[model samples]
Target: MAGPLLDIEGLNVDFLTDQGWVTVVRDVSLSVAPGETVGLVGESGSGKTITSLSVMRLVPDPPGRITGGSIRFDGRDLLTLPERAMRQVRGNDIAMVFQESMTSLNPAFTIGDQIAEAVRHHLGLGRRAAVDRAVEVLDLVGIPAPRDRVDHYPHEFSGGMRQRAAIAMALACEPRLLIADEPTTALDVTVQAQVLELLRSLQQRLGMAMLFITHNLGVVADVCDRVSVMYAGQVVEVADVVDLFEAPAHPYTEGLLRSMPQLGVRGEPLATIPGNPPLPWAMPEGCRFHPRCPYATDACRSGAPALTERGGGHFSRCLRLAEIELTGAV
Candidate 1:
């Protein structure tokens, strides 16, 4: 395997509460090679977003803290880096497109100004050159009439356009790694397809690695080279997209695949997992997903299973992985 662009090992993020420190992410580990797109998928509150935030070192400080593990980007361990050095690496070497463009974008600033700010800060371009580059990136992201729309505020653009603009800002510096946290959550199917396609095209053109976070299996199938299924802050499975879709080793992953609406099965009820995901403060002691997992056994309920390789580079954290087959139960 090629050297990873981003490598995470035994990563554990915690939140300090009145009671004590609660671990939200538990021993999660994964890596992304240069130009490779990795998908982190799970239901809401599954710690997918927090994992990405930890990598960017943007976790809320009052309560949140990275208690253990190392996040290495390129060759440096980011956890030990100073705030000043981390800032320099953030937008220049690794950029992120947040889940909600509305919350991330500045309401007071024009779209052009926002994009130009990133360009100027990272590339040190003069104002005029930054604006020009901003327009170029906007055009590249498929924004029509970039020159006119550049002057419009975030509110002036439609939801889809705002998302594209947000993506444009992320790509403005041509960073080596791009972390997109649910980038297509608010868009319609048509617009979502366009945005996903644009991301794929840009990735190929720029040869940049991507950490694509989403709950949509369809989106993962369309863009991700590898898929990591997360549950209650732990990575239950990781595999190439083809291997994962064809023969998912983890019950949680099989459940998610079965839950996706299929074209030929219109009248059938959508499949669902048995229980809700555990809260950060109250995660289960053993396998976090065992309560909802149909194939779970006594061992699954008593002790958490470490992620181990099954076959074809697929790794699963289920104790019954060797006994279970992919029968597709949501």
Candidate 2:
């Protein structure tokens, strides 16, 4: 197989709060192949967003810092790269469509201007050429009347339209990798479906890899080729989407799957995982999910489990993984 387009190893991120330094992401690692769509799924506050921000080296300063890790893009170590060089790579090589388009877009600038700036900077196109290319991208993302809407401000567009514009900007330069952090969070179901289908079509057309982060399992199954389940700042399991749904290896993965409401099981209560994710500053020792895992044993309390390969490229980080039944009931 070809090398990964993006490779992250031993990645750790920390924030310096009034209470002192606290680790938020711990020894996490993941990769994306060229043109592959990988989903990062977890409940809210499970560190999914932060992980994507870390990849872009966009973690806010004065508090957060990447203490340890190697972020390699196309075999080049990004962490060691100079800030000036990294800046050139950001929007050019790895662009991101943030969760909220309302907050991400610049209210002062026209949507076309914002995208044109990216294209001009990266592709060295003149103002008129960049604007033309921006409109072209907007059309590619299924935004009708691209010529007319290109000059409109972000606030002028509806919620779903704004998201499509944001996505258009991210794809303006045909980036090698795109990190979409909850791209459809605020949209209605119909709009969400449209945006997801657009992304899938664009991915195939552009031949670009994607790191799609979302809490929606249904979305993961629909778009992702592989899924990585995160819990308490660590990846609990990584597997193909079918394997994950059919036979989840980690207890946390099982819990998440079981929690989804089924259509025919009306009288039965929806299954749920017990307890909340531990606070980043106060994460428990050893296995983070052991406290709530039904199959947890004494060993789980004393030592963190290594992410071991189970089979078929599936990996899990649970000592009692062998003991847990997929039925999700102890």
Candidate 3:
């Protein structure tokens, strides 16, 4: 209905290495609408994190740079924004919650102080007002005794509590877009579920658009409205969550779904995708995923397929979209 809150088109990122400048993210495109959650699912080194980092203009230059494409957020091109303007956009309009809470938080500072800094910077609140704002946000995130907990350092909190603190800091400015990079990866199963539920509730309460980056399809199923599957350096498929789970169109998407460990099959070996993802410096010609694609044909090795529509907003990149009937995760 409404236009995408954040739209990325033809995004290309390169990294300088001993060999040369090799593209790590190529012609990638995706979007997130207001109040919607979109999952970017892929294995390590698939360029998922790179894409998100580029959005915040936090990509480490020299070693990493976004060479092409545009990141349009709420009608403005973020890539072209001046640094001072971008800084305002970073923690205020757009915020990121990294996977590791310990790394994201500062052990030296009190959790309240850390959150208060962002509120003071973005909202331009005075010290007392900022601390009060921090307590309110901590309470919003379901942390107990927010007034007292705010004075505690990072080490004083447990893993899950630290994560909640990280989230509180991100939401302190009430950002329009929240980029969460595997926020639940380090937690146990029960904690993971709690965190996921927390994120869902917060998103609904705040009405913020979320770009959830994770390799876990199960999390995608529970939290994301739409899913984008990335491999090598390209997006191979995009679909609605229910449609993707019921009828995945691409071989790569099918492989990922089939590889998910099913609950009742305890004795059987877990299905796996053969061969590792190719290195960015030495990517294969044509379709980047052809090497690991079970249904790849000669055409697949000759030229990369553009993402083509498979009806009802489901798009897939494959030479055999018609001939193949891929299995679904459900």
TM of each candidate vs. truth? 0.97, 0.97, 0.98
Candidate 3 lDDT, tens digit per residue, 38-80? 9999999999999999999999997998999999999999999
Best by lDDT: 3
Assess the local accuracy of residue 218 in candidate 2 as a C-alpha lDDT between 0 and 100. 85
Q: Is candidate 1 or candidate 2 better by lDDT?
A: 1
lDDT of 1 by residue, 274-324 (tens): 779888887777888888888878888998798999977899998888888
The alpha-carbon deviation from the true structure for residue 95 of candidate 3, after best TM-score superposition, in angstroms, is 0.7
Computed on alpha carbons, the lDDT of every model, listed in order, comes to 0.91, 0.90, 0.94
Q: What is the TM-score of candidate 3?
A: 0.98
Best-to-worst order by lDDT is 3, 1, 2
lDDT of 2 at 178: 96
lDDT of 3: 0.94
**lDDT by residue (tens digit), candidate 2, 1-330:** 589999989889888977689888888888899999999999897888888898889989868899998999999999899999999889999999988889889999999999999999999999999999999999998888999989999999999999999999999998999999999988999999999999998999899999999998889988999988889888889998889998889988888888887667788888888888888878888899988888888899899899999999899999977877675322
Model 2 clash count equals 0
